[model samples]
Target: MHTSEHSIMVNGIPIQEDDIEYASRSLKAASHPLRLKIMCLLSQHEMTVQDIVDHVGTSQSNVSQHLAIMRDKGLLSSHRVANRVYYCLAESRRALLQACSSLR
Candidate 1:
């Protein structure tokens, strides 16, 4: 990230439309607690769907549903193994999840 990367204005009113759109999408995807946790877990290393459920203490179906949403939103990526799927962060930013962990 660069200091000028987040510049908030053309003439001081607001930034480019596309920048706002991207930021809005990113923030919205990060809005949920569970989703945030999932991202955090993935940030560390790849894990199976079951591992996420175990660490987050949620039902398999529920976790899968949440993961689906995150995947759709571009926050998570998945790969299929022989009998299971693995997941990881879409990008590498270990520190991004630190703040989320302390919130609760």
Candidate 2:
């Protein structure tokens, strides 16, 4: 079979090489154990860094590092309200998370 025939497609459109690279990076960011937990938590609602640390039962510094990684990869978005920074799954990624959840 020709290599072109094996190219990945999404919604009837061929995914660009750069898009594939970006998706791979984003997926990797979410694949870590702690990050995955954080994603699942944020899937329900936005949470403050402290809230995440509490639920995940980890140090604030560790949770903050995971949050930074996911945020940098665009899997998450955050906003500040007064003194608190809240995080939620990026709008574009919500459907992806929902779909993943259904697989279990």
Candidate 3:
């Protein structure tokens, strides 16, 4: 194994440092069960906070906190629609979600 400032070489294959960092951050954010559930839900389509709370059978406040964490970690993106906030997996993280879904 060999490492450089921008990449790592394992078995003669180089992996970009940025990709590794992104994977680390995304995995950490989604490691929580509630957050994982939210990601799986959003993998299907964008949803409002209330919708996620209803589907996850949790309190709105609980859902909001999880959403905030995921948002801060760059695993999710959100926008306002009138009085509602809709959230979806970040574009860069969608491939990660797809890879996880394939395991199910």
Q: Which candidate achieves the best lDDT against the true structure?
A: 2
- Model 1 steric clash total: 0
Candidates' C-alpha lDDT = 0.78, 0.91, 0.90
In candidate 1, stretches whose alpha carbon ends up further than 4 angstroms from where it belongs are 1-16, 92-104
RMSD of each: 6.0, 2.3, 3.5
Which pairs of residues collide in candidate 2? none
Superposition TM-score, candidate 2 onto the true structure: 0.88
Ten-residue region with minimum lDDT total, candidate 2: 1-10
| Candidate number of the best TM-score | 2
- Report the lDDT of model 2 for residue 1: 48
Question: Considering summed lDDT, which 10 consecutive residues are worst modelled in model 3?
Answer: 1-10
Candidate 1: clashing pairs of residues? none
- Provide the TM-score for each candidate, comma-separated: 0.71, 0.88, 0.80
Please provide, for model 3 over 2-85, each residue's C-alpha lDDT reduced to its tens digit, 9 standing for 90 to 100. 457656677889877687887798899988989989999998999999889889999999999999999999999999989989
TM-score of 1: 0.71
Instruction: Quote the lDDT for 21 in model 1.
Output: 80
Ranking by TM-score: 2, 3, 1
